[model samples]
Target: MSIPLAERIRPKSLDEIVGQSHLMGEGKPLRRIIESGTIPNLIFYGPSGVGKTTIARFIAENANMTMYKLNGTSASVADIKQIIAETEMIGGMNGILLYLDEIQYLNKKQQQSLLEYIENGKITLISSTTENPYFYVYNAIISRSTVFEFKPVTPEQISPAIKRAFDLMAQDIGTEVMLEEGVVEHIARGCGGDVRKSINTVELCVLSAENGAKGELLVKMDTVRELTQRSNMRYDREGDEHYDILSALQKSIRGSDENAAIHYAARLIEAGDIISLCRRLLVIASEDVGLAYPMAVVITKSCVDSALQLGLPEARIPLAEAVIMLATSPKSNSAYMAMNNALEDVKNNGPLDFPRHLQNKHFDGADAKVRGQHYLYPHDYPDHWVKQQYLPDALKDRVYYEYGENKTEQAAKAYWAKVKGDKNG
Candidate 1:
């Protein structure tokens, strides 16, 4: 069996590494640390394929230290103790680096076992995680180590690496290799800033491809597409990304950007989170497209019903239509704002009694004249409409439901003003 192209081309020295210029650039903190040959107890945090594990290997190799690698998913406290004991047997744990991948998978108890080894300097622990360490890693472990964040490798930085992979493939196959124009660009973009994924994609393409008439391995765009599926869509269905995408979708609709709104809706549809999509759309209808387009809420509900009946793949159609309708509709948040403001006042002031006239007359022994004192019956008046005190005495002057600026709201606002002789009534 041959070594994977990604492993074969892995950078042994920091100089050979591509991307992560922010940390690996000249005179950068990481460069300075690695060049000094003094590795620290550190955590490398970032997205996958951005060279976190590679960097750890480079650190251990560059420092001339004996390194032990462990997967946190499989490594138990006993395994860690055994590794530490091995280091102890080899003369008191100096110059020993332990690389633990997926460190966030280790529970608090498992994490606690590392603290003693780290505290005593028996082993330099360099952990890598794809999640935000501050949220996932143990506070004690994170506090003791320096954190280096690895950013996504940009297209320009990753392009040369793709070419390097081509050369490596040619060497491995003993033939000249050729790639169609834009193939490298396409892979780089599709890999979503993951260099490892891009390299593996290239390797897969070359391995699966047949030699051309001239015996040269020619990789075409379609071949690349067939080998490499769509770009990695970074989303955690129940994590921060869930709320983030929902916020983006709602904001895009509220901002009336149809393209952006539809794009975000597609993300939710792709994730198969129909319930979240429905909930967010309903909210957008009420909170964003309120009285300005009252029918939007009804349309969104209908779409939700259609999505439920149709289910995925086909469900995306109704979601897209709802996104487009909400995105293009006139927006007003007056009703939402009114409810929120009223809620705040109610919360602060405690419960207020209902108006005397509004109280149930069906209650046994309830008086209409004395207790309901001066309550006028609107049915006896012309137009069957009357302006009477609805708000509690304390909030009589408080205006919560001010009409928004839109044609529909303006018409309603005008009628209220005419009926009550006050615009805010």
Candidate 2:
């Protein structure tokens, strides 16, 4: 069988490559490197289907260099050595540009083996990975290579690419397929900047319509949505699914939906979003649970720290625990509102000067001036309650934290009320 449309139409030159104008545009760093004929050992880090491999090929072609491509997922250390040996044989004639895709999958040992060759300029190494290299790649290997981050193809770019692909296909088949208006835009949005997936979905729609004897292919929004849902896994790191999952997580916590929260947490963890999952849980504990269940915040923090230290699989346990704790805790937005209200007061009224009597007096003769002044130490008073103006003068009577009715906060409120009455009486 012939190659797929996406592969068959792969850009052979820089001019043919889509998107990535930031790097391929005139006077760009990558453009300069290619023009100078002195490409450095570099790592292309970014979201998938954004022309990482295509850009690498453009650079290799422009420089008139031989390209040696390898998938780090399937290749072993022995495979790397063999490629290197072959490159060295032709080293004196024309240099070889080694393109290692998914380089983050390489273990430390294999990564270490590539370091010498990269640094010594034996191979102009160009590696592409969808992961953050600092976390996944060996530090030694990272230090040896210049890193270029590629952004996902934006909707503006994807629209034109889809049109170009569709137009080309129509010309080849000798049939005019009228793409429904705004259909390309919908597909672009659904793809979340994944160019390959967008193009493939368009091809699928066209093929389906052709078989059905439809002269005009109406690629509806629903069709695009269904294609995205069916073909793509729903939790990509840099895709819309990431944001969707995050939103679900926050809503689940806010609504006190423990089951839903845990489900969202599982989805994030499965998609390798451990850090985001832990961070959101920590925020939920403090902002949503707060003093209503103070232990929730403590547990969440402990989980975050432990997850960072322990890393994956094992780390997932602590994250799961924190998610459960945050979800099940007494739900309250008191602390979140309190901070917001306090910040609003500050922004509107400006910084309030500290009361002269309450100001720090470390200098000589300053203590006497401050002593026996307006300041009242709440701890020293009966019931530990002295209702001095804690808020600034502009917000003196403003109340932000509405204590929740949970057992823990109710008790705290009662204790504070007794202390306030006793000290004032």
Find the candidate with the highest TM-score and give its number: 1
Q: Write the per-residue lDDT of candidate 2 for residues 1-425, one digit (tens) a residue.
A: 15667776677667667788888888888878878888888899877788988888878887788888999989898987887787657552477788999998888898888878777777888998877788888887788788887877778888877887788777767777776577788878777577888778778767665323556555555666677655455425433235556779989988878899889988777666687787677778888888788888777898899998998778888887888778777877777887898788788878886554466653446445544456678788666666766655566678877787788878988988787767667
**For each candidate, what is the lDDT?**
0.84, 0.77
* lDDT value, candidate 1, whole model: 0.84
Clashing pairs in 2: none
Total clashing pairs for each candidate: 0, 0
Query: What lDDT does candidate 1 reach at residue 137?
Result: 96
Instruction: Give me the displacement of residue 356 in model 1, in angstroms.
Output: 44
Worst lDDT run of 10 residues, candidate 1, spans: 232-241
Off by over 4 Å in 1: 91-93, 230-259, 268-425
Error of 1 at 290 (Å): 16
Candidate 1 structure quality by residue, lDDT tens digits, 1-425: 17889888887677878888889989999989988998879999876788888888888878888889999879899989988887757544457899999898999999999999899888999999877789889999999999998877788889989989988888888988888899989888777677888988888888877789999888888988866664344322322125456788999999999999988888777767677788789989999999999999999999999998999889998888899999999999999999999999999999987677666564434444444345778888655667688789888889999899999999988886686664234
Off by over 4 Å in 2: 12-16, 90-92, 210-222, 234-298, 301-425
Write down the worst ten-residue block by lDDT for model 2.
234-243
